[model samples]
Target: MPSPLTHDDPQAFGPYRPVARLGSGGMGTVYLARTAGGRTVALKTMHARIASDTAFRTRFRLETDAARVVGERYGAGVVDADPRAETPWFATEYVLGPPLDDAVELCGPLPEQSVRALGAALCGALGQLHASDVVHRDLKPSNVLLTAYGPKIIDFGIARAAGDDRLTRVGVAVGTPAFMSPEQASGQEHSAAGDVFALAGLLVFAATGRPPFGHGQAADLLYRVQYAEPDLTGVPSSLVPLLAQCLDKNPFRRPATDWLAAELHDGSGEFADHLPDAVLADIGRRAAEVWQIMPQRLLAPADEPDMAETVAPARWSRRRLLLTGGTATLAVAAAGTAGVWAWNERGGSGPDRPPAPGPSNRLLPRKRLDSIWQIQVDEDDLFEEVMQPGQLHVVGDMVVTVAPHLIGVTAKTGQRQWASNLMDSDWQVATDGERVLGLGPSDEGASSGKAGGDPLLVTSIDLLTGELNDPQVSLPEFNGELVGDQLVCTANGIAYVVAGRGKFVHSRFTANQTWYLFAVDLSTGKRLWTTPLPARRSGSVRLYFLSAAVVGRDLVALQEANDGTVHAVVRDTRSGAVRWDRPLAGVKASSVQLPLVTDARHLYLGAGELRALRLRDGRTAWESKSSRPGRTYGPPALKNGTLYAIEKGLGMVALDPGSGRVKWEEQGGQGVEADLKAVPVIGTDHAYSRRASKLWAIDLSSHAPTDSYRTTGNRFIAHEKSRTVISMGGNFLAAFPLR
Candidate 1:
């Protein structure tokens, strides 16, 4: 009945009653309070810390002025403010909905279509602000909100007039570094174009689950913003060109807000009516197919039956028989099937007689041969447990997966056969027809010679009966290679030990420090022989970075020297020797990792210089320079013979990998802050670009999105196939079915 207290320590003003404290920022504390007129409003009051400073008051006044100016132009008003109050407070329209940061955290990264929709919406708002001559100096996901109707940009506290002294001081840099513009980082003037640049950074977060510049401290990102180009490698394709335009280095070079608004909102008639009927049907068909196979839906807690908790598997009895002295034979058969046949046709007992119950056993139905059931091991569904999808190796019916955990499942029904309790951080799984090889560090660890850093633990199992076989191989620190009837283990790029047949063959790394190959036995720890050639660094393979593929036995590495030279090295695995070493021609401020792809004879690499080199001689097969300017962060996606490189600060370029000749160039959005950092993930007929919090599934045949997923929060990172897409952001992982 009485006026409720606002803050825990209330400091009431004339005719205003304080209630609960909402939140605090750098300059003020916002309180949820009611006025004497009985209307509730969010009252933001200056913090006592800065209330006495004349300069701080001036800045607050400027903020109030900017808000009023923008509101007048756009029909959106800042309701109340008292710049001269003992503790200054202002009230604006309180819109409900989570902040963009909270939205991304809750819903995961937005789809490509949703990103585009958000871009258009924000662009329209920016257009209105710019028309009123209001410059929003700080633009980031946290400052934006997705309301029920549309996205709204809030928190103009740091915004200033064109020539105000309210600029960030030398020791204090404002705004989140990941979203700051290059000019802002360098203490340049904050203009409408700066907002465009900040928008590009925001878009990168929307598309990639990660900021364009990431992982480092805030100062590092600030340095990168001032001196380096944004890494748009994960941004979606639909936003690639548009964002590139916005991220231009020179503010004068950026397009006006009106133009940007039109380009984003109207899409220049390029992707008009892009969703084809065939594409729509395929999406529906895939969804239906997956739904049908799902035995029971994972329903929420409110579901009546609660299948997730209540359903239990029927138990069955089993008996073992001695086969050959101590060897055991376990038999499983359906109890009901045997008794039903004996009762109806055999006529031994009537159904109503209640014959004595036999063994409780029921055989599971045989599963389909192609089924794959993956159980998410992480309770949070975080997907962090599974860093990357491991290679699927199949031997008859057993499909092995070496991922978050090592598991062998039946390829038919995704039923797990056996799982090993091996806590290995860095290990790989390989197999032969008769045995599975788990290559990992021994229990003694890398430093200890007993277990060996690279141990080869060979496990053998029956292909049909799922039984262990005799004669297992355990060797210390071995790179086991199959040659003839033995498994040879190589250690220290020097010694080799051969296993199988109880023989030992030894070899050592040649003194030449050049190229070397060794032959060894599998069964015993022994080396066979060694041939020498050149010394090799750990990271090089093809003698080309982002430009060459190390296929088959060759491992590719990119090494940067203090002198700023990038060396691409190729090493042959059969013999720990350098295959070739070549210099990659580019002045890279930062390095990015790229997966190597090759079609045997020619080695292909992606960057500004898309080149081909002869694998045997390290000679240039063909070379072509990229059309995009600035640093190239994204590697090209290769399909068939076509090489697609989505250049940073540039759009998509389709070239012939063999000849290094341009086939077609898709125009990208570039002005001041634009670039294509989001690498194009290509499929058979389509390619995807996940730029800042959006997803764009482009049809490679038409070079346009057949259909897109947008209209959500900013995206941080994404992965996709032709039919499926997964993106992770602030909180959850988003799953989408691609058409």
Candidate 2:
């Protein structure tokens, strides 16, 4: 397939031919070519300048030989090559299809099955490469080609043979630092396990659509890959164990390639089945090791603070979750060996609607909340929602979310109400008991059709009809609160508003130049005085604005100063003057959110720790300190006077809010990090907890056996008046009636 180089120059040399362009990289270009005899081959040529150097040619020869020596497995096959050719060329089988990055971008991450297949193929390729004493210096998404046949590892230009002197030639580091194993990045020679580490990196890219180290320059990337653990939080639960093994920093700990291949091949049909036999063997082996080592190392030292103080102790609680308990259940035959099971019970609150007229106690693992069916509404390839404060706001039965666009979904069904197309608006929706208020597109130099100097556009729609009750209203300073019909807000440091409208709007801009909070007048475009508050440092000390809320007649604007104090200023809604300014001591806050709990006496806020504070005075009524061992990231849910807190790996903790007394706790599975996305939901007679990917319900006010609701996928807690619903994983939200 190659065309002869007929230029005939002495430097160029003979009838060298050009073949199909294979791929380009930082070092050189590769092509699929052939000799005059029609034997197919791959040819890689160095860029002109690098090709001219004798030292470069020698290194190229070593890389070519390493490629050929690594031979065929599931990857592209390296054939004969002329590393000594004038331009220094090597040949490999031409592979079809786009790079893995392109493939995922075009078609999304391969499903669990394909992901397992891809992993198996790459593991096989690496097994062969490692066996031949070669280290693929670069193993990134861009270098791995996803052919129709399977994934084929390619672009081994910088590959190095074990103990090859060519690897240290001149200044060539010989690997993409981001994908390089930590040991290799520390100036050590690549190990077989390092290739396993690189394969882990590729798997992470396949799962999250971004490298674990994120985008950065070579040095920063290498620094991160060396010291930081890849954020595998979003990875599918089934693949976590395999990836964790592959990413083991110590070479001895990494699973062998044979094991990896078997894991992939066996698990290719269903993610649940993909456990490499080696991984299972390793888990058992490690468990024994952990048991032996942990006893000597003091896993639970005698004098450690009592974890029981954080939550309840034993009745299905999170307090004891820190214990590295290894209990397993074998009830469901289909659940296989690994994976968590839903700890459920029966006989709780009746169904919210007509209690499903079915036989009771049927052992349906997936339970439908009375009148409520779960629906996993999230689309594939979607990024985690990252809206602050009001990201997840509920207005009647309609919940509006603004991660950038104004999206509305039915609170009961998870069905999309509507997704707006207006760009740069960044809409935020709030409600005034009757109508929905949208505040956005009214910032200075407004690009959207909302406004320019008075960038705040206020529209009020009936909460039930989703129809505009009041036409567009223009208000100046575009920030504030709604006390009944008064639209109070502030902009440019002065609080003002268009009064007696349908709703009040407020706009608060953060230091990052994005509006954190914006409220609009639901009735008339009247000029409202806007007050600007000092900005605060976020959790990472990033510049951001303090948030505000309208409680009764008080407009409380809370900010965390440069010093770690939560400054709360209560402004009068009628007048712009501050009623009281007090800093809550001992509360280190990045951002504080007060969930709209139905009681004015109880204030629910989230920061580094989830705390229940009294509204009358800045007094911590109760706090869930997740800083303890085993307690990861999760917020506590407060209902009535009881609080439900969860710890990673442990289960749920029920506490008495007023006394900070542990009432009950449950032993779930895994840690809080696994189920942080969902909060516990409580109804009149029952409580529901989401663990890992399952939902379970516990009955209260009963001395007999508890009622349990079971569900699949992820579960989220949604509250409505007297009814509570569980957003069961896989698009099912079930509502239970409180009776």
Winning model by TM-score: 2
Q: Give the TM-score of candidate 1.
A: 0.35
Among these predictions, the greatest lDDT belongs to: 2
Model 2 global lDDT (CA atoms, 0 to 1):
0.49
Score every model by TM-score. Answer: 0.35, 0.40
**Model 2 residue 607 lDDT?**
36
For residues 96-204, write the lDDT of model 1, one tens digit per residue: 3345666566556766755665666677666555543457888888877554234557677888644444446644566668888777777667678888898877877
TM-score of decoy 2: 0.40
Clashes of each: 90, 61
The 10 consecutive residues of candidate 2 with the worst lDDT sum are: 334-343
Writing each residue's lDDT as its tens digit, candidate 2 over 265-380 gives 55333322433333234333422332122101112345664231111111110101111121211111111011011111122221122111222111122224434443222211
Deviating ranges (above 4 Å) for candidate 1 = 1-8, 11-16, 36-38, 72-76, 166-172, 267-739
Question: RMSD of candidate 2 to the true fold?
Answer: 24.7
